[model samples]
Target: MRNEIMRCFAVVFTVIMIVSGCSGREETKTAGGGGEEDTKPTYEFRLAETHAPDYPTTLADKHFAELVHERSDGRIKIDVFPSAALGEEAAAIEQVQLGAIDFVRTSAGPLAEFNKDYAVFSLPYLFDSDEHVWNFLLSEHGDQLLDSLESSKMLGLAYYSSGARSFYSSKPLAGLEDLQGQKIRIQQNAVNIDLMDALGASATPMAFGEVYSGLQTGVIDAAENNYPSYYSTGHYEVAPYFLLDGHQRIPEVLVISMTAWEKLSEEDQELIRTAAKDSIAFQREKWAEYEQLAEEEIRDAGVTVTEVADVSAWQKAVQPVLEKHGADYQDLLDAVEALRP
Candidate 1:
């Protein structure tokens, strides 16, 4: 009887040990299964833009974030800081180059400081229309100009809608002569300054983020920007006049630091490329809708929308500004002109 009891005890002990070993193996498999191990590497991407959250570029960034998350299966996440939350456009571009930040959506103005060739896009009347700008970006010359950033530690992903920048002021501007003595806020770009000067306005180079306060405080009598920006920034509240001169159709670039780009996996890079292309199309559509809506909203707000009699008059006034930069950017200027109908 004692031997039988010992045998039964031994059997129970062996069964418990077997069960415990199996459970341990199951736990190990569950923990280390597939590519989701607790120790697996995760990549965090940060993007900065100096536009309001409701702007089309911000919407594009949001779409990019979603697509990256989906494509990477949550292995990668993008954090988008809008409205200069990370820093102003110039500062954000600098941070991206140093690898302190992953991405930035910057206008051609600040980007020109890094690559002078980018200044071509900032030139007055560079692109005739939105379609012209879009075609140029996809063209060989556009690709070359954008790729020039490789030397600056930045890689261009895509171009976002900048819309045609036109003048908005408290006073009416029927012709180039009307701009005489007007204090117009221009971007911190030499071409813009020269253009404004040529057009007979007192050109004040200021940051886009500062334009509203500058206008409100009477620091500036007029400014130039897209319809959406004028309305969204509440500049309409002060300026109250919109001029459809369509002087420059500058496109915003979506760029990533080379450091960040090189760190992405091959498959991940492909996913990003595809997503960027899709986001570009998405952004363009949103831009059109926003621009139309902005026009109506600003008009309803008691702002006078003026259609200049002859845009050629304004163009002729700024021709000297073009001639000054033509030698260096002649090739790009010629190519853009060739695209005109």
Candidate 2:
């Protein structure tokens, strides 16, 4: 599994570098009458996504691209590559830094590998609720966190609502004790692995593409994700019990390559930024609609919608994981604690 995942990542880097790094895409204007060079400029940008076209993240990217093109009067074209056409987000992130790709939409899990400060947001129950998460993202502190990526050669443009993630398994989760001994598939990362360990479940990390099959074959007893993803990926076909524990409110982000940003004219830069921030409202509304639709439809399919009776117990159990991980990044933890709903 590890070798296959690495191979997937390797192919992305090799192919994308040749296309983006070794060449530049341009849009040029023709001289009106005289044999003079065209002064007007043109640009073509690439936006990478790991979700299907109908997915919320991909829909938002398309909407954002449309707005950019319309707002820029067609001088800027943002070609949206859905379903990881360019590469997985993790691989595209490095390419984004080198200007091999212009934009990416991904979860916070892979992003933390690029910046430790992002680790705070990935921690379980870090926010009181969705509104609390939004408040922090829109606050002055949130802007600072967005700006934090400047050091990493990327710019955090806006946050898209991914909703809260919960566990869905072949069997129902009655409470915290139910998690003991279950083999759960989590994002391949230290924080997530440690999170499962703390809960007494064995963490199995694998590619997202292989998850549906894994669950069907009993390779993993349970897998966790947002409701839209759970439905969209068809994981519910195997894991019929979904516990609305709402453990992690992992928000997705739209990022631009800093190297590419630097090359754009100041006026164009402002337009891109404005369009990106503007897409938040559109994406959030679509997300809310999808969340409602998924819940209603999934339950109607005879799947059990289990409610987490005692969240306090789950939070208490996961506290040690947060404490240990937060020790290295104390300021951010303090910042999260300082955030009041």
Model 2's C-alpha root-mean-square deviation from the true structure amounts to: 6.7
Worst 10 residues of 1 by lDDT: 21-30
Best by TM-score: 2
What lDDT does the true structure give each of the candidates? 0.83, 0.85
Question: What lDDT tens digits, residue by residue, belong to model 1 across residues 1-341?
Answer: 99999999999999998555321211112245576654433576789988899899999999988988797677677888899998988889999999788889888778988888888877887777788887788888877876789999998888888798889887775666678999998767678778888888998978788898988888998999898899888999988878888888888898989888887667777888778877988898898899999999999999888887677877788789878987888888778887775
Clashing pairs in 1: none
lDDT computed for candidate 2: 0.85
Which regions in candidate 1 have their CA more than 4 angstroms from the true location? Answer: 1-40
Across residues 284-306, which tens digit of lDDT does each residue of candidate 2 receive?
Answer: 99889888998888998888888
